[model samples]
Target: MNELGLNFLDLGDSDKLPIILIHGMALDQTMWTPQIPVLKEHYRVLTYDIRGHGLSEVGDAQYTYKMFADDLKSLMDYLEMDQAVLCGLSMGRAIVLRAYDMYPHRIKAMILSDARSEADSNETKYWRENSIESIKKDGLENFADELVGNIFCQFQFQEASGSGGVNSKHRLIIFIRGISQPLSSSQMMHDKIVNSEFKIIPKAGHMSNLENLEEFNHNLLEFLGKIEF
Candidate 1:
């Protein structure tokens, strides 16, 4: 409980059922900034830094998405939450799916943004392995700079605005900074968790929520509304 507590950020009313927001790899709760204010108006929102990222202390490098799901379950137990909505992006999405598989009873609904459930493409896996080797040899900073260009749509970077008129440069900057921070080897463990249940968000690159906020929000809100709370 204490270990999990150190990783989460509790926002909005504690009296309400929690809505946990799990961010993608490298990024932290701050990535969910746009959704917080609006979501808090209707539900208690909980966001967290995955272990080894953000304010959370790094855990074992030999971890899987199921382990992350366990962390969420542990956090919910510590907070005394019975069930909550799980919203995730990219790596976060994998965690949510694993959580659903592990403790479906604890999840009221799920929202996966800018993510897929299938394992990384062989090409992507090769790149990830190469990048990890490079990072180990060089540093996270250099690796992050090289990675940013693939994170957002070219139009978003060029227009300086994301879908639905959301500013992307600011988001991109924040994301880059987060990724540039120290990260543990646990990130490589994600490669072991072959995702196969993911659905792609249209017109989104990697940062789907920021890339297509309007559509993402509408789909998210609609899913929330349809669920029997």
Candidate 2:
């Protein structure tokens, strides 16, 4: 839709509620496929490939989160969607969080999964850049191996066989350090938004939604049910 040429999937009737699902880094709109069936039953669900992530065009200019947010607005305008429930995982959540600043009224609610809502620290930023270089120097498979290992072994939310639980910031660091960071490091966003929910899918990592789709969908349906009440 629009000149941006974002590849998107729209499901359900126009008369139903609207829900937009935004995916994280290294992921495409298909990441939300498991949730679409349940969501489309009651709402018109919109799933799009963000620029440079999937099939979307990658332009020369370096972009900011706000630019991504603007692209969302452009798409919304094209679709004549006034407001919708926004659900994002990791970096996807950050983009929508920025969108709230420019168009607060456009969001009906937010679902922030496996992401913080604060600005990135210099150390975290540096570490990610370093990790990217490592990925390039080493190999994509190795990088994936390390990432998945970290998630399964060192990054479990609840206490598990070999993993540790993160009740405080110290243990949480392992989970937070990644390719797709959150919006900020403080609860300021939760306070600012007023109508938001944080869902922690246990036994899962940064890719929590994908790792545990059953529980994820259960929680999601419950959340949406509440919104209707």
Candidate 3:
């Protein structure tokens, strides 16, 4: 654990450039279980639980993407890493983008899976408010099904924000999306990052990396191989 009390695992050669994996909301670093062993063979890997999730300490302050990005930067500082490739899944994508926006020099590249680049709509805001109210009223476990249903079944995830500062020319970005999920957002991101590569994982849903580990890992490794790093 670092000074922020975040539970993290740093694996592979310390001499190699690192690849940091950021999991989605409601998920811990363990979600990257399948990819860890494979990735560790080539580069240093870092996986950590976001604040308030898994074993990470949750402070009294309200959580925001900016804060999460700060935590990521702080973790890098603690590890004495000057730069690393960032791989984010779902809500993790937002955190990655925010981090790049704030500290572009620290990010060597980006791998965004199941990403979204749009601002949240009013309906999304309403649903988020309703979900919070429901969770508070009935507790997390009781509202789990409903929350998951809305996010997965209905495909109503909170959209991303603060992407205007990300410039495509300076970095190599890879976009990975599930074949079953909506592709518009991924396409938008791909278009935004002209030099970025995009891949679709077959027979996968929102959680593409977990649902189709083989294909996901293949794409990841391919990207890693292509990069100069």
Candidate 4:
């Protein structure tokens, strides 16, 4: 893991083709743990924390999808990645969409998971505002604990509940630990989430990757496989 310019976790053989993985808001590179082993078997996997979320330096500028997209582009340029498949979840997906819109030639294909392109509904926006307030008031630690429980399906929750029922709890602990650091500026991210123009994954909430991992991964791999390398 390097945090010099952009905080990233580089895994697998560097000589292999590059694949960039972008995590959603309130999440860091660890979100790709499930996919890393599978992906690294075929390509060089690079997972990074977006600015303000992980070990990356929280810049003075407000967060925006365009800024996030620019960061990815800059990272790719810095690393000399000519073109690579960009896979993102939630906010990460928005970043990739903006990146494609800004620099289409730099991206070969994209995997958008559990994310939306359109702005959130008034209800959803209210929820986000409440969430932001909760995070600010009670801190991310407690908020993360409450947040992860709502991410999975009831069936999944039941299964987890049956097996000593701590997966979600454990995952939340890890997630909260990662994001417990101070935020740079969430105003841009908050605004973007509230007033996004595109909503790609209508069925998914925030944690679409985990809720529908199989389907999501299948769609992602299929898209990547179809791309002409």
RMSD of each predicted structure? 10.8, 8.2, 4.2, 12.4
Measured against the true structure, the TM-scores of the candidates, in listed sequence, are 0.75, 0.75, 0.90, 0.72
> Of models 3 and 4, which has the larger lDDT?
3
- Cand. 1 Cα-lDDT: 0.64
lDDT of 1 by residue, 1-229 (tens): 3555456668887776578889987678888887777778778999888876778877656667777888888888988899888887777867876777677777776665554434667997798679868888988888778777768766567667011211222111011111222222222222332321223345556676776666556656655665555
| Per-residue lDDT of candidate 3, residues 1-229 (tens digit) | 5567899999999988799999987678999999999999899999999998889998999888999999999999999999999999988999999999899999999999998889878997797678678878988787777645534522224321556777768888999998878999888878876788889987777888877788999999989887675
Q: Which stretches of candidate 4 lie over 4 Å from their true place?
A: 1-4, 161-208, 211-216
Q: The CA-based lDDT of model 4 is what?
A: 0.61
lDDT tens string, model 4, 125-154? 698779878999999999889877665445
- Total colliding residue pairs, candidate 4: 7
The alpha-carbon deviation from the true structure for residue 90 of candidate 1, after best TM-score superposition, in angstroms, is: 1.1
Provide the lDDT at 146 for model 1: 77
Q: What total of clashing residue pairs does each candidate reach?
A: 4, 5, 0, 7
Which ten residues in a row are the worst by lDDT in model 4? Answer: 169-178
Q: What's the true lDDT of residue 94 in model 1?
A: 74
Per-candidate local distance difference test: 0.64, 0.67, 0.86, 0.61
Best by TM-score: 3
Best by lDDT: 3
Q: Model 1: clashing residue pairs? A: 117-195, 117-196, 117-198, 118-195
RMSD of 3: 4.2
